[model samples]
Each structure stands twice: as structure tokens, then as C-alpha cells.
Target: MNSIISEGVQVSVETFYQPDYSNPVQSEFMFAYRITLENHNAFPVKLHRRNWQIFDSNGSHREVEGEGVVGVQPTIQPGESYQYVSGCNLRTEMGKMKGTYQMENLNNKQMFTVDIPSFEMIVPMKNN
Candidate 1:
């Protein structure tokens, strides 16, 4: 839960999740996450795309590379935060996700990277 800015733009990430215990046969796993980005500089910033590496409980892995999140590239003004609710489905019971965001500062004409911290997706051992 830590973030920093190189030139004035800041990025922060938080991950949340919910499990489907009743419809196990559906082979569906649900996840939720919120991404917050703040522009500290005088320029505006844009989040262009995402690259994710998802790891399951069985030592298996999956890659999800996509353009933007939820089909829209977000632009944030200075002192403002861009937040979104996004998710995925897993065939397995538990896993974790981590990735990076490609962002650009419009006013500076510079591009920088943002790290999306890895978060857990699981059904607690006590419940299992």
C-alpha cells in the first residue's frame, strides 16, 4: 500500500475480493480492486493500459494483457484521483494478481510506469 511519483504524478493500488462458495461447479472466481492515481503536478495524466500476471493456488499461471481498464483510458487532472472497480474470473479456488500500468503525462510529454501491487484471492483456511 505504498506509492511514489517521479515527476509529480502518484499511483496507489488496493485489492479486494469475494468468493463463490455455493456455485463451486460454475468454476467461477470473483475479484475486486480499486486503483487510485493522483496528479500532483500541473499537468494531466492518463492511464493507457494494463498488463497482469495471475497465479493460482495450484502453481499455474495466466497472463492478461489489455488496452486500458474496463474499455476506457482514464485521464486525471491535478489533485484528482482516478478510481475504478475491475475484476476477473478464475477456474481455480485461490490465486493472486499483480501488474503494471502504462501512464503518460500530457503536459510534460513524458511517460512513466506505475506498479500495481500483488494481492491475494483466497478462501480462508479456517473456512476451508
Candidate 2:
């Protein structure tokens, strides 16, 4: 798991390699990641957008940017948290991902960016 705190928001990530969904012969690897966003500020926050940078060990790279996560913009209350699961496909056995979330302070309607700590996804056997 990887974690970071930015702008009073805590972002943590845990990655899982989905062997069942991966085709080693085809050079396709699938990974699922769970992200937890915790609001440490005194005010509530609403997730507005997300931007991701994905890299594969094969020298492949991509950027993903869009509104919300998993199709919904979540609102996290002060001292509360929101969790979501998302998937990514890589051309290699190892890869890393990092991103940022654009969030709005519900109390003041101010926008801020929170860093999502970098996390790695690797086929279990590849770790050795």
C-alpha cells in the first residue's frame, strides 16, 4: 500500500494483480487498485476530477484524465472517507501509477489538488 497526505486529504492505494483476467501469452496484464480518500480537514470535500499517469515496464506510458472516479463524484465529510476500486491494463508484468484528485471544499467552494501516492502492480511470481 502507498499513502500520502496533501491539502489535508489523505490518499492511500492498494494494488492487486488479477491473473484470471490477464493473458500472459498475449502479454496482457490486468490489475485492480483500491483507493481510499480520507478527509482530515474540518470541512467536507467533493471529488471533482482525477488525472492519472500510468507506466509499464515495457516502456509504455499513458495518461488518463476525467471527471470523478468509477463514474461518480463522491463527497467525503470531515473525518470521513470514501473508497473505490478501479482497474488498469498493462503490457508488462510490472507497472506503477500515480495521480491527483481535484476536490472542492464544500464549506467554501474552493478547489484544491490532492496527491495520490504512487503504487506498484506486479504479478506475484514476478516479485521474485
lDDT tens digits, residues 1-128, model 1? 54555456666656555654324577666666666777787778888988999997778899999889888999988888877777766666787788788889887778888777676666554236
- Superposition error at 20 for model 1 (Å): 5.7
Per-model C-alpha RMSD: 2.9, 0.6
Tell me model 1's lDDT, rounded to 2 decimals.
0.73
Candidate 2 global TM-score: 0.98
TM-score of 1: 0.78
Number of backbone-clashing residue pairs for each candidate, in the order shown = 0, 0
**Every candidate's lDDT:** 0.73, 0.95
Candidate with top lDDT is 2
lDDT of candidate 1 at residue 19, scale 0 to 100: 58
Candidate 1 wrong stretches, greater than 4 Å = 1-10, 14-16, 19-22, 124-128
